[model samples]
Target: MSQIPKIPRRIVTGIKNGRSVITDDAIATNVSEHFPGLIISDIWATSQMPADLSTEIIVENTAFPVVPANGSYFRYVSIPPDKDLGIKPLEAGQVHPLMHKTATLDYIIILSGEIYMILDEEETLLKAGDIVIQRGTNHAWSNRSDTHCIQLAVLLAAN
Candidate 1:
């Protein structure tokens, strides 16, 4: 199993006193431990309805309790090689243990290493610089390499 790398802390810059300033800097929130060798960093998120803003905001919200409608979420995910997810396939229809439907369009980009995009009876190998547009489909990610894989995903809530 590959070890988790020392990921850099996140930094948010905002206007303070009519000038740009460092507002917040820390790791991501809403991280899930459901999968082994998997690390998800919730970067940013927004509400379904737009909030009335009287002033400029740096980081409006970072919580991801649930995916909002008409909003979006930016996330960072890392998967280690030869991960033992212990996920079993679903019996009803074609589904994976990590497979779940979403009401959003996901833009997935591979940053480093290699991974497989698992679907129902199908798999696609993705490498660095590869991109996948997941249209709210049932899918999962698997790292079969001997190294760690990093990916960035942007999920946009769809109607």
Candidate 2:
């Protein structure tokens, strides 16, 4: 099992009566776990409605939505390394079958280590600093190495 990193506390500062003060400082989120090494954390989300600064946090416990509702704000996700990505038989280029699709557009960035972005029958090897813009498609992430691969994925509502 991969040891997920500690999520930083979100601190919201504000001005009160001409004085700056921290209005909210706490760990806020709604997390979803997929399988053993896969995780999705919803840092914060907003709807199409007008902004509400007074709202501290909006909790979401639903599975990754097939399609984000209209006017919904984007969702940020932190992807930890796949500790079991390298568990394969002694065969070359033997990738696992962990493919799925989503309706929202996703922007994924490789923060550390290398990973394979598999789509349909094709795969692309990506390393640190690499980026992938996933537009409502089927795909999966494979870390074929022993080290963990950290990634940041931002999902936005699709038309």
| RMSD in Å for all candidates | 4.4, 3.9
Q: Predict model 1's lDDT versus the native.
A: 0.69
How close to the true structure is residue 119 of candidate 2, measured as C-alpha lDDT?
A: 81
Per-residue lDDT of candidate 2, residues 1-159 (tens digit): 456555535677778998889987887556665555555556555554454555544646444553346424334344444555334532456545566787777788887778888886788999989999899878877766666676766666676
User: Backbone collision count in every prediction?
Assistant: 0, 0
Residues 1-159, candidate 1, lDDT per residue (tens digit)? 567764547787777789888887886544654356666667776655473223232333332224667777777777776445554433457555455567788898999999889886688999999999988777777677777789888888876
TM-score of model number 1: 0.76
Least lDDT summed over 10 consecutive residues: which range in candidate 1?
A: 56-65
TM-scores of the candidates are 0.76, 0.69
Candidate 2: clashing pairs of residues: none
> Which residue ranges in model 2 land beyond 4 Å of their true spot?
1-3, 13-22, 49-57, 61-67, 71-96
Clashing residue pairs in candidate 1 (N, C-alpha, C atoms within 3 angstroms):
none
lDDT (CA) per prediction: 0.69, 0.63
Q: Which candidate is the best by TM-score?
A: 1
